[model samples]
Target: MGRWAVATERRRGEALIRAIHEAVLAEVVDAGLGQLTMEGIARRAATAKTVLYRRWATPFELLIDALGEAYPVEVPTPAADNLRTDLIAALTLLTDWMVTPAATAVMAITSERGRYPELAEALWDKVFDPRGGTFTTTVLRWYAARGRLDPARLTPITTQIGEALVFKLAIDNARTPSAEEVAAIVDEALLPALGL
Candidate 1:
């Protein structure tokens, strides 16, 4: 028999992108931002470097794109009547996402933002900003628009309360907050600030 090359099925469309995203996140979490590279991601993803290049010019660009895709969006109650429940759910989403590889990669980028200012900027611009700014911002806005929350109270600081507390507790405790802790944050901290 003549020697022949073996062919394997290739990932395409959303599946391919999802694999690439997961690879980049794992790369950043495992190797850190300084060590992230197209070669590294492609190797982790089991794809060709040419495949990554076909979509992104730099490793950071691909990383940003991946982060944007992995980032979560909060879904508040449609009627906007359950502010506390919705806020708890919003903060719960944050806590849930905190344990993911993508969230770990985000922490890596943010912790080293001073060293990688451009990367941090891209994270904010490309990922967080486009995704409703913060965890509770969307829910808060939803309530305010429905007249459940006062619009004037939805300042930057107020909108950040849930996310800030969640991050602070995570940093201090060395773990993501639990469901009760998430609810406490909304009740004890966020609601008071919003004048609930």
Candidate 2:
């Protein structure tokens, strides 16, 4: 291809990718996962069905790509000096994410995981593990630097306490915890669990 032709093609490709991502989220939000289909996506995105087939082999692939593109996991900076403050900040960021439309997509994927084991593995490997892993590593490093991360006490279980609690509140109760609740989790649960 000529230089301008190559550039034009690249722009078109980028736009198609954006459209596909948007269509996936909109479809799930509007119609739920059951009604999400490749044909429907192509129609909503105003792209050729061949384009989607060329890029993604299955709805699982498309959905995973869209979710990853839409909700890039963000691990926040520590809030303040202490572990309590920092842990609360990290957990709070997670709480905020849990309530977003992107998280609704996540929940949908998770709910379907039992039926589609590969999809669950992909979601964890591609999306959840990277983001959650980074945050967990950051929290551990922060506490270790402060000489507060106890070797025996600060295991994966302890690290996940705050996040677990928040997720429990969101999943079991259908409510995101208040700031006070987050603080209580940090002060009463995470910090003590970490032996900090």
Root-mean-square deviation per candidate:
2.7, 5.0
Per-residue lDDT of candidate 2, residues 35-119 (tens digit): 8899988889877788899989987799898877765444434442566666767777777777666678878877887877887
Runs of candidate 1 with Cα error greater than 4 angstroms are: 1-7
Q: How big is the positional error of residue 155 in model 2, measured in Å on the Cα after superposition? A: 2.2
Best by TM-score: 1
Mind giving the per-residue lDDT tens digits that candidate 1 earns over 13-108?
999999999999999989999999999999999999999999999999999999998899999989998999999998888889999999999989
Q: After superposition, how far is residue 118 of candidate 2 from its true place, in Å?
A: 0.8
TM-scores, all models, native as reference: 0.94, 0.77
Q: How close is candidate 2 to the true structure, as a TM-score?
A: 0.77
Native-referenced Cα lDDT, model 2: 0.74
Backbone N/Cα/C clashes per model: 0, 0
Candidate number with greatest lDDT: 1
